[model samples]
Target chain A: MTIVAKFEIPYLRFLDSEGKINKPLPHFAKNSRDLISLYRTMVLTRTFDAKAINLQRTGKLGTYPSSLGQEAISTAIGAAMQPNDVFCPAYREYAAQLQRGVTMAEILAYWSGDERGNQFAANPEDLPIYVPLATQCLHAAGIASAFKLRNQPRVVIVVCGDGATSRGDFYEAINLAGVWQLPIVFVVNNNQWAISVPRTAQTNAATLAQKAIAGGFAGEQVDGNDVIAVKYALDNAIAKARAGSGPSLIEAITYRLCDHTTADDAKRYWDPQTVEQAWQEEPIKRLRQYLIKNKHWDETQEAHLQVECNQQIEQAVTEYMNLPPAKLTDMFDYLYASLPAIYLEQRREVEI
Target chain B: MSEITLVEAVNQALAYEMQADDNVVLLGEDIAKNGGVFRSTVGLLERFGPQRVLDTPLAESMIAGVSIGMAMQGLKPVAEFQFMGFMYAGMEHIISHASRIRNRTRGRLTCPLVFRTPYGAGIHAPEHHSESTEALFAHIPGLRVVIPSSPVRAYGLLLAAIRDPDPVIFLEPTRIYRLVKQTVPDNGQALPLDKCFVLREGSDITLVTWGNMVYETLKAAGQLAEQNIQAEVIDVATIKPLDMQTILASVEKTGRCVIIHEAARTCGVGAEIAAQLAERCLLCLMAPVKRVTGYDTIVPYAKMEKHYLPTAEKIIKAVEDVLSYEG
Candidate 1:
């Protein structure tokens, strides 16, 4: 038989689950300051996740999706992206949003069903949270196409969940990106579950990363629990995109250690044993152990950071709580550039 | 002054806008080298180059979502679905993102994109290729549904659609794309959207229609005029954020209305207009508001299509029934 072609998916891992270096550390690992910053953000994200769950349980907030074991993926994304680059995020990407300068109060307001949360002044041009699974992949491809058209140096990083990779929108987007050689980086968080359905049912593909090959781009995998590995992969992808080399797909393998959302009861379908197993490789603890093993962080520093995270989160919660509710007319004001007669008449009926 | 068919007029509008605005771009399947399946985008890629006129892969949802992204980032992208029947694949993006982005972002980000596709049944086309589903887009809150009947209106309204601050669904009448030619001035002028164009004035009855139905309604009005029963013709250019003021004023004058459209009758745009007129101008209406539209069934294949569309004769009969009604 004549050989036509062959392909191999690259895998990346800098640290083992126990915090020991399994491979040569990437450049980001050599910078203790950057590593410490990533650790701090991951800690802060976890702290926020716990408080958010409490808020939901106490009826103070709406159902919130936690970033439990996947903190490293979002942290690496946020830390590695340039300010000018656009971040297209899925709903579960609260950690990434926070890293990109979105305030905790803003996220809280959004989960509470307030439109004001999407008005991000810090990341003015960034796309707001996408709720419909893989649709943002196309939006990112479009944004990247615009950058290419204008000859801009900026790149777009669009993140989606493992299940989103099964959607036609994801394939269509990556196909177009490949055809146009658009400046985009697609990061799929393969967290092993899509609500009640497991990853095995979503696709029979060997690795989610390999799906990029069908769309004519390079695909690679990374240990999502290892922030250094994610950062390394994301940095290289973004750099390649900005340099106009074309788009790349990075699948960050992780595990969902919590229920899909506050509204879900994973205990109904998930085996408790698997959940217990996933907790062993959780990202926050892995990074913390690494920091402690390197002597860059001690028990005293960890305790201080915890107290600080609590104070900051409490302040944000208080600020969000004290704000006045949005007005009804606010709905009519933004529906169009100018209010038409139909809306005016409707508004008048409501005024009385 | 130049005489051009409606399809040529569409090409003119796209070419003119691409020249006038650096941000205006065209993207669709076979639009670049093939100049589109209908040649509505002929000479665009040659004039604007591949950068401005992109030939995308055969994916409708991506075409729509990408346009939204481009529009958000200060580019005016005009995306084309090969036909309206093929638009259902893109309906998710159109309904979810295109229509709600402006309101969702509180005016911080607006989608200034135009989704163009040819609609209506005629010319012996296949089943899905001939669909008049403008009402679907018109029903969307944040979208402006614009349809043009003649060459002149096609050129003018298309420019306005691309220039609109929000998303607009520009549905072209496939039947009349090359059926007739009119002297359309090449001047880069756009007609006002969200306004009804009164084609022929009469105080007897208002014949409200848009897209290809406008042609039949005009023909029916002429036949009605010969019978000494003058019928007014009003082309509703913009279906959503409908120009009800103009329609209501005409109905108030004529005291009768006969809406015509080649879309499914149930929950169609004609139903909305009829309901609105009944609510606001009930006392002024001399007779019941009537609708001459396509059946509630799926548009039939080529052999059965002509029997499915709304015709001038059908429109005239409805006007006669409303005019002669005692109730």
Candidate 2:
């Protein structure tokens, strides 16, 4: 048996980190509508993140994780996916959820700790928010396995963080996905930090993408701050997955420019210089500058998009805040088709 | 009726359910080609093919987690965890997600799945081979916990669990897999998922138990019969629903009670049964309720297993204690 000493990370990107496309741009759409749409969604998600933090500070919402600087990755992946394909997102995938049809009001309600906000009716292709870390990878693999078994032509993309790669579920999921050659893509958002612990402390490996090589699959590393690069790489990987080739891991090297969640303070851990460096490479600004420089966007259009996004986000927040208070027993109702005796007794006690 | 061992009965149940419903599928480690470690799924691969009888990897969480997704997609999946003790690895999926899917989705989705594994002590197996953890599943709100005492009950309860429109954990007693034989009904017959059965009737004291412990309880009841202490025996086929009416009625009629189980004593099924009796039938009690349970500790390996299990003698001692009490 030949022991492999090393493997290479395969990244296919048309755009560099400086917003320059190395290859000629494809003749898809020059109307700038798509670019404007990406900008609007990113701004909306950012606003949502800020509002969620404010709500938590005022005791109006539960602990919330913000996707502050990772907007380009989520927006680009959402843009490249087909409607029939399924999206299994981690808790920090607010932009992806919004782009894939989850209402802002519903997402806010979920962050507010209401079960009704977890509703997944409109987007049948989207899974509920997976909060248990890397467990969603296994779910995505299962869905992809089912689709393969039934001879269906759909890809299942699962999103996870760098911390999730160290979890056993991540390995089990990818291993199964490889064994069965399922149509799935595992996206690892390497935000560099998992709460107070840094990514370097979590794994000794050089890159999270290389972990996929152990399962006999290739992976790529991309600049997560560039929307163009993210879209190009994801589109190729997703196409390869849908063609029945198997699974691929995409490690997007991004930064968590904000705290891990609203309940945390990054100032307690990271130095101010590191945080400042991350803010300089912010995904939204990089994409916005590219659009303006290419004459695809102007100051008038940017101002118009900002006003529209702000109005939409405010409306969603108002709708969420006006909803009725959640009931405690609502937790007991949907566990099974019929409640067991123990839950019934507990419900009765609560009623009394 | 055909007489068969508990292992054969479980195999027959899977075969019959697979034949009756096209939606029913089985998946687990070595469940297809190897026919399961206990041969509980023998001859299923030839009949159902690879799609229906899948041999999964040795990952427990994926086994249970994938079953939840399959059930959500309108398939009835019966997954085997090989042994009850290994079920702990998949407890997150069982207790948190599978049990809460229906409630979490507000009836929009239902996990019609069944997890089957052998539990209880009596066999001289290695460490982690024998465990009685029905109470853990019983304490969860959305799950149904079933423990059948005999081959016939095993067949009937397995069918009921497969047909039930919810998730159920079917605990099969491995110690008695081939030790006892009973005449089981033919295909399509099923016992109610939430009902209890009265094995014997008497008036002196009520003996409540389930699973393999039911045999020991019956033996103790027989020993009491010779001493003129007529003890009533009730087998709790369904542990979660508890069939409180049957237990409460028996406790009220006898005015004395003894709960038996092979799990740890601290928070076993016996504790829940005794507590329910105290809260519901305290006025009718002539003596305080007694309990016969295994000591609170990890199940020791083969040589000392008998000491760790609650036996007939232990039940007899608890009965004597309750009989001699003046309270």
Candidate 3:
């Protein structure tokens, strides 16, 4: 048999597990401020995640998913996208959503089962968190299609998990993106686990990034624990899409360092030793190591930043807890643009 | 006004909407070049150009999900499924995102789209090709499930479905797509949704139906007219947010009712109508409500299609049974 096609997936990592610079720093990393800002946001994300888990444990919040080890990936994505560009994210992108102007209270409100949480007042245009896996991939393609049709220089970025890659939606979306040459980016947070199922069990493909090749676009892997690499890949992909060069896929290979959600028990499926070993390459620790090694950060700065993150999270939590319950009629009021006359009678009987 | 078939009327409505609104777009498999599997979108690709009439890859879920995304951006996307059977692959998107986006976002984001598909089990189609599961969509809160019986209603209702500010499931009856013709004007006047259309007036009994079953029910009404039964026929156009008041008024006048549908007997739209009539019109009724529907089994292939579909004879029988009640 003759080979009709050939392809390769290039891996990228600016800093290794020990925080050693593997190569010369990219332009963004050469400036200490950019890296420091990224570092600050990631730390805030981790702090927020921990506080969310604590709230869930204390019966203050509903089931919540923590992006404990994958802060770099989500934070980098939020930084890469512009304000006008749409973000069609699956659940579990709190870091990105926070960066995109969604308030911590709004995010908390969603997990607490209030309809208003999805309003995204500041970022009203971005998609709300949809629970279904990878279904938003097509939404990204469709949003990109609109931009292309209207000749707007806008990009759409959609994120999903490794398990979502096994779904037809992911494939169909990437395929449509390729066919239309739509302005979109598909980012897979290959966090090595989809709840109890591991990456190996989710697909037989050697790498999730290579899946984009089948869709007639470029795909590559980035060190999700390395914020510089994640941001670099996202910046390139978003720029390409904005320039009308079509779509790209970036597989951010990170590890899920926490349970899938408050309702899930990853310890039942994960090995203690394996979890311990993964901590060595967690995003925040390596970034902190790099900053400290470069003298851009000191013990005094780190201690003050931690206090600020805690104070911000505490204020958001206080605001969220004091919020009033949504009206019972909110469900009916927003069911349509205006309630149909036929449903008005039924709407009146909406009792507890 | 031009006399056109039901499918032709659909094409007219789509063409009119695309010309009137720049945000209106069409997307589906084989829709752009092939003019749709049923030719309901004929000449759209040429008229609107590729930018508006997009021929997407053969993926049902993507068609639906992408439509929601496009709708969120202020574009009205009329996405087509090859058949009602193919809609199962896309229901998660429709039921989850399209139906819930408005409520989930508290009106911040909305899905203003029309999901069109051909339904019902006549004309000798394949197994998965013929499906009439309108109840599943009607049960959802944010959706408006519409099925037109004739060319005029099809044109008016389709125009309305596309213009409505929310998600609408426009299920065209494949059995009657080209079965009959009517003088439908392309004046761009959309028929009112959430209302039933009275096809015939009578005092003896009410024949409530929509889609292909409306044809059979109307035929049954005619047969009853020959027998001096004088049956009233009503097409419940928008099944969800149902125009029950019209049906209730007709039932209150006729004192008897027979609900007919092409979908399965179990948990069908007919069942919902019958239940509502029982609750609202029990005091007005002269007889127990009856339903004439397809059986609760797989929609058979070509050979058994005639046996599976509700016929004029079966509708007449159900009407007679309801009329024979002696309360």
Q: Residue by residue across B178-204, what tens digits does model 1's lDDT show?
A: 989999887899999899999999999
TM, every model: 0.99, 0.95, 0.98
Off by over 4 Å in 1: none
Q: Output the lDDT of residue B140, model 2.
A: 85
For candidate 1 chain B, the 10 contiguous residues with the lowest summed lDDT are: B118-127
- Global lDDT of each candidate: 0.91, 0.84, 0.91
lDDT of 3 by residue, A189-238 (tens): 99999899999998889999999999999999999999999999999999
The C-alpha stretches of model 2 lying farther than 4 A from their native spots are: A1-6, A26-31, A341-345, A349-352
Mark the 10 consecutive residues where model 2 chain B has the least summed lDDT: B100-109
Model 2: per-residue lDDT, tens digit, B200-239? 9999999999888888999999999999999999999999
The B-chain TM-score of model 1 reads 0.99
**Best-fitting candidate, scored by TM-score:** 1
The interface root mean square deviation of candidate 1 comes to: 0.8
Number of the top-ranking candidate, with DockQ as the measure: 3
